[model samples]
Target: MSKQGHKTRANLPAGGFLAIGRDVTSTSDTSRSKPQVHKRELPQLSSGVLKKPRLDFSGKIPSSTPSTSSVKRAEVDDSRWRSFCAEIQIEPKQLLASLESAKEKQKPQKAARLICAAVREIIDHRKEIGSWVEEPIMCSALMLFVKMNTSFLLPHEELIEVLCSLLSTNFPTSSPGSAMAPLLLYKLLMRATDWNWRLVESFIDDSLHERQWTDRPSVDGLIVNIITAFGTRIPHESMYTACDLTYPERYRTVAEINRFTKVTDKEQKIDAFVMQMRDICERKGESAPRNLLRTMCTCAGNGNVRLLAARKMDSWLLNGKLQRYAMELLLWIASNIGQGELTEEDSETLSSLLKLRALKSKQINILFNIALKEILNNDKGMISAVAKLLLSNEFSANRFPYNMTMIHSLFSFDNRSASKVIAREIAQMLAAKEEYLRISRTFFREFVRSLLRMDFDFALFTSHLFNAATEDFSVLTIPTFFFKSLIDFCVMLPFLAITPTIREASQQRRSANGNLTQTHIDALQKFYADLRNFFEICTCFFRKHCELCTDNRLFVYSYYRVLYLAPAEYYTGIDQWPVETDVMQYMRVISDVPISEQLLCTVLEAGSDASVPIDAADTVDVIENLTKRASLSSTLTGSSMVPISTSTVLETIFRITEYKPPPTFNVQDENLPPLAVKTLYWKAWLISLIWTSLNTDTLVKEVYYNYPNLKLIMQIVLTW
Candidate 1:
């Protein structure tokens, strides 16, 4: 038969198998010197058909310790030889099969051969292929073909061009063949772990310019298989290739992912993959066990692909990319979603990543925000996650950072109860664990120091929102340090306090107060309620122990004295004694009440005592300091003001009322202002005025009458 005729006849339809040609001379020499490969050990595929060759690696090994190395090398060489032989046979059989297959299944020979040649060239020179500068379209097309073959017969690096080419192609839904081509292309691209990541990026860029996937058939099975193979192999496929295969946005990259289906269902697929990877990754460390998962995660992030791509996040976490990539993905994705929808799998994965000793404080903070957001959003499964993280030996509350937006979202978002619950959890944690409290106290102190300078705009601030005359203090309010924080926050907003009171003044002053919205009233009420709840908690605790501590009369007296200065309501059912006073007297009689322990000792030690005294002069000094440090303009009439105390007196009063520790005189600092020191001394001067005003007016009325009840509180503490 003519060569041409034979070639044509060979191109028939039977799914022909190929057998490679071995160079007889090289094979004989190598066979004698090298060890043998046991082909029978390989796993069988589809119908017990062994598509592989009996690579002969058992010939010999020069007695250099006949170690596994020699055996491995021999085996590798033999396998290559066998693969080459298989390719040779297939050259004839594959062509014939392609030509004769049902015409519907047949693709053009030129296209197929071009792709095949490209893959062969890559397999032959993987190292050289990485350096190839010429962008070959044929080679690119081959990448699309070889990406999913699972045989590992081709070099992954050369598939870059293929990915780039495919990415550039417009959506081809015109024919079934064309549609199937992309799916096949994605499968192949998924395998090119060694390809240049930049090439994958180029594909994303090009995909941005092209059309989107619409009614696109999901190659879910193909993706599943690829993930399965790589889960075990952890192949070094390009991240962009993984992203393109998983998330194809028809428009601008990552942001366009929203056009795809809701990401909720993808959790199941990711969870399964993660479980598989966990099982496999723990088994044996391979050459590049983490490479496949890391690359895939990176691709998802870069491509702006959401959902399925996000499912691989655990893979990144397990791979120890928590610091570099995993944390960022976790935070960004949580923010994008409402945070309430995070899957348990995601929480597990994140928790595992954080447990790694390699993670840094900054990384922890990022994770904290994610967890905090999840809690804020009321993710059902996240409570346990937060608890676990908080208890971790690596937990550092101080490391967590918060932005205004995050704070706003925390208060404004739907899961208000969840926020309160988390806050309580944190409080319980602090109370139970000394080490945790010490660390957390430092963190909260720093937070307080930083907060005075922050902007909590009432207009946009979530704290301004209310439900049935109540503010959403669940996020804004808490029982421990957070309660103090909320008070401080409200105190910083002098106008919120001043405006309501001013409006209640005579008509002249009332006219000056702008029309206060119901939001403002609700905010004030919420703020008060939050404080009231905090006081109740303190009272409740004291009531439980006061009976035991009464023998220590000083302790009870000191505790009552501090309480008297705090803004408390007189219980209508009882004598006009303050709740603080009432509780103190009851605890004063308890015989077991550690009488040796004085209230002064407790107050000094508590450091967290909210009733620390401050005076007018001290307040002014702080105002001056705040003026110097405040980033926002001092103007109160417009949008620039960031609610800080008005004058030194108001500042001291606010500090006293809001639980801020009174600034003490630095006797040694000669440079310190005399007036500031004098203010601390005069803390008691306004007490009488404050005490007298309380009986006749409500909190709203006392401040409304411009009686300077706030000023009285600060002045009295200084004088006392």
Candidate 2:
């Protein structure tokens, strides 16, 4: 044999001399140090032909002569494999055979470790054989394992760790089977015994904070699926567990989660779960968990979910538990959802929220602002519904302050629609005079003030009021102050040009030609119609309760102010010339008092020039005429009327009064009629009669009791 061949032969195993496929040649000693041989290559025959080596049936084959199959078997028993089997206390082949068998029969206890091992292996080799997770065998085996070992798996934190790792690592790509990891996890959780929510929560926390699953939608979908699967199985005792499990502290709110991923359906399920828990709590007479309430609040962005959540919250609010949370959820729905989509239940929920007087002012403001926007933008009956609620008897005095602001905001958002609905409700309330009187005074004032703020067609409202009062005279029996508020609202309409402000704005809008435009003519014509309707309403009211018109000095003053301040153009070309004269005639007819010409002259003179000092004899004559008309005295004797100056008469009359003459009713405004001056002085004369005839204590009591009316009158005067 050649020296190189000898050296190769010398290096061969003791059991056999291996053959080389390549030629052996003389080479450097360093290159011949180790012989490189392909494991599969067999020793050659003596004729130098290749053939498989015969197995040695003799004592035992040399360990160094192990076949390629044995070497591969050794590689299978690597450190990872040994550790996996050791941890489960199962042999490698036994675990595999058990898993294979478990796929069919699902033997209890025997295959639990096998199933876990299979999953661990699948995850360990995720990058290479991730597709294996999608196989039917693997999926079936996993489901069976969970079914058979539910008790064991429930507390098995190690298995949970492995599954969560799989979820975190198996981020789905465009690859065909990349999503199977989450699917398998979902199926496992769904079929498993009730999960240890603590473990589940930890998983979610890790997935969100550590894995940043929210950064990847597919991964987020995986987490959402897992949560949905486990969330439904949450025990009622731990119902709030789903909240933290589904939406961890890292993702605080569903809204914040939405910023990163879309788990809308999952959030809906969580809401339903929490709501079910709330119902359970209610039945047991236990307070609902506030964490669950907070969970529902965070998830209120979903429409259907929010509706249900709103109702749940409303119940809590009514029961006076977690009212803050209930209010929060309701306001969220109101602001986020359109008013049109708001169900009647939602409206009631918001109404109930407003009814919660214990809520902070800021929360009330938020609730009302949302409701106002909803009423305006929503074509649903929310406008009418909320309007009725605001005007309802249940909206008590404690809530009145908030209700008033919300009512005004409603009108501000949509003047036309809001006012129409509100007016209709007010009219209906008027029909039930007793019930209407029961309404909050603040609400009634706000109703009137709201009407005045918007471009409401007062003609319609006044006509309704007139018809209602005519049908039932008791409808006109509201407080004199409220009646005045109504009158002030109707009489001060923008198109009527009755209030000083409207007349001033109208005068400023007149053309250079000093002629009204066609638009102005139409408005003026409509104003005449509305003014007539309003006068009809006033006539109906005064006819039934003429005492209210005559006895209430403030009422009488505003009534005469509205009647006399009416633009002259409306009553022009008619024989019943000044409407104030006609109103005075009606008053005299109703009360059997004679109309005094001296009083009319005094008003006309005051209207002609308010700055001019009245002659004392004229004032004394006016006072004597008023006193005789009032029947306080048939005539003022000279001794009784001795030395009474104009200042004394004026001070006695105007001292208790604080009303300012309207700026627009001055000589500068062309719209004011020559007889319009009677509004201030006639008001003064009638006020003096009512004041002098009535007890001073009574007058003082009326003035003091109706301070709100005084404030309202001041607002009107300033606005004018």
Candidate 3:
């Protein structure tokens, strides 16, 4: 047989496999006829045994049955051919015709050598085929093929090079193939066992410089995909390096970058990378790069990431923009993380960061609340740190309310050690300078009120305050309202032991004989001691700063009320009535100070009315009688006792007689000024004092009864 004929016969379909090659010498009609015959015979051959061929004159019919090895080889080649045809979107006959045309174009020996060399080259460099493909379809097809061939993996270095080249090309403008480059490269890199991060980073740097890749909407997404793939493979340190190199410096803020990139979730890897860089920087005792911090700001919504970023806030405190961002980041973390998760170091760091004067009041509030939570958890170090922060210069007048509120919260805790620490800091704040008084009077008053409401050890706070007040009387000159609040707190101290809650607790510890336990006795004695010391300090304060008393009569009245309500046992055991002497000295200094005519009329009016309405009082008769009495006294004594006007007396009567329940006497009066409240308190105590004195036949009543003039004076004073 001729060589061409043998080749043609060998190329015919074997078993049921499709014929991959055709005879080049055959005409189109003959080729078409031969394929039809094979197609008809293939199904029958596959389903059952081949029928015996009829005896022919042309020797025995050539055996059409294929050997086992030939059948297996044919099947494998047929599958590969079908897949290639499917991938290229061509029919088998069309592929065969094209192959024959290509064969006709080149000599057989040369074509064979070329085919062998190409096969060898593909086998040797199969891993690099992804980079060599320039067409988008071919690149995607090659990557898909590589994915199916599990044993083959492209080198990441070549993948990165291809990705960079694709990124540099303007896709949908220059070469549409670049559009699939990111996805193709992603698949290739995923299959790689190891990556060249430096090469990846270099590619990223180069790609970032090309505005087409980063600015164009269609291309930027592809670029981000490439970055995301790189992120998945790159180590954190290398990722950080890549971020530093690729992040655009022109975009100063996270918001700006987010707006420009429009790739929100894709930047999570960048966020993580920057946070790691910051942690590393902090571990090395260095400040995080400012850009790294700015990157962190973008991911502040991530609680864990924000918390990690908050640790480096100290370095950013000096930067105006970063400082604000850092503070906001901290606020977010504090709000999201568990309260118990805050560590002492975290609290201390927040406290230190709080020193920035640029912090907003709202930001300060959040930071303080975080510290406050730690304090309530009984973290002593946090307590101390927070206390210092409260007193720091950062807590300006704008933040004073929040500062005092924080202190109040700390004192509210049942933890004694925390209270003591907070108390010390509060004392320092109160006495550190006189300025806090004028600036934060209302806050301080509420703070003191809150502290008194809790079961706090009043002595510790009062003692510290008293010691500082003694060294500097100005300390006692905190706003009159705050000072009065302190006095009210002191007055309540002695009665704390007898409160129902205290009494019940003490009763539980009572001895078998029904006597108070030594613990209860010691507590009572401490209360008295603290109360005595407080009153003594007040006396000294009034003596030196008598002008303060004159300016604030409510404060003076509060002091006198505290003195009058204290049990006599407190003074009897003390030496020479030092507190009492100081009080008398203060009174003597103010003796020459003229009483306001209104005060005189209020006194007479209150004395004259027996059935005074608790809510309102009629002062008309009282004022007329006071005017007439002043005139009568002036005539009788022939002295220049000026007759006060009815309006002045009426004004004084209204001021003094405006009745409201007093807080000082276990009454819940919210509207009354502190002085009026104290006056009502003193009036109730005075009535009790008079009743007790009369019942006991005290010396003052005996004197009143013994002298006729004194009898008349007492009679007038007692009559309503």
* lDDT of model 1, residue 412: 39
Task: Output the better candidate (1/2) by TM-score.
Answer: 2
Q: Which run of 10 residues does model 2 get worst, by summed lDDT?
A: 66-75
TM-scores across all candidates? 0.31, 0.35, 0.29
Task: Please write out the lDDT profile of model 3 over residues 548-602, one tens digit for every residue.
Answer: 3324445435444444423344332222322565434322222212223433443
For model 2 the local lDDT of residue 165 reads 50
Ranking by TM-score: 2, 1, 3
Q: What is the overall TM-score of model 3 with all chains considered together? A: 0.29
Mind giving the per-residue lDDT tens digits that candidate 1 earns over 1-720?
368546633542233322324544456656544322212222223223422211122211112111221111100112322233234322322433332342235433333333444434433333243323223333333333445333433433323344333333322234222234345444554444332332323322322222222124354332222222222111122322322223323211211111113334444534443443344334433222333233333333222223433444544544543334454444444433324455554554444433433223454444544445543344545544544454343355433323322333343343444344334444445434444544443433333244422222321221321121022223323233433322222222222222322233212212455465555444434433343333333333333333223234333332332233322332211223224653333222111111111221233223223333322343333323222222222222232222222233333333333222235843443554334333443442333233233223323243434646555564565689
lDDT per model vs. reference: 0.34, 0.44, 0.40
Clash totals for all candidate models: 48, 1, 1
| Per-residue C-alpha lDDT of model 2 across residues 1-720, encoded as one tens digit per residue | 488778756554343564454575646673454344322232433313311232221111222211222111101112443344456543433454565565567444345456566665555554554445344455455655555555444434345445545444433343222334444444445444444332233333332222323334434433443343322111121222322223233233111111123333555544444455345445533255444454444334445445555545545665555666555545445544543466655565556545545434464455546544643454656666677777673354444555666666776776666656666665455444434433423344445555454355666656654444344444355443445444544443322323333343245343244554565545444554455455445544553444433244454344354444333443332223236554443333212222232333333344233343333233333444444434432111111211121223434444323233466656443554344233444565554434333333334345434444444554554589
Candidate 1 lDDT score at position 609: 38
Highest-scoring model, TM-score? 2
| Candidate 1 CA-lDDT value | 0.34
Clashing pairs in 2: 607-677
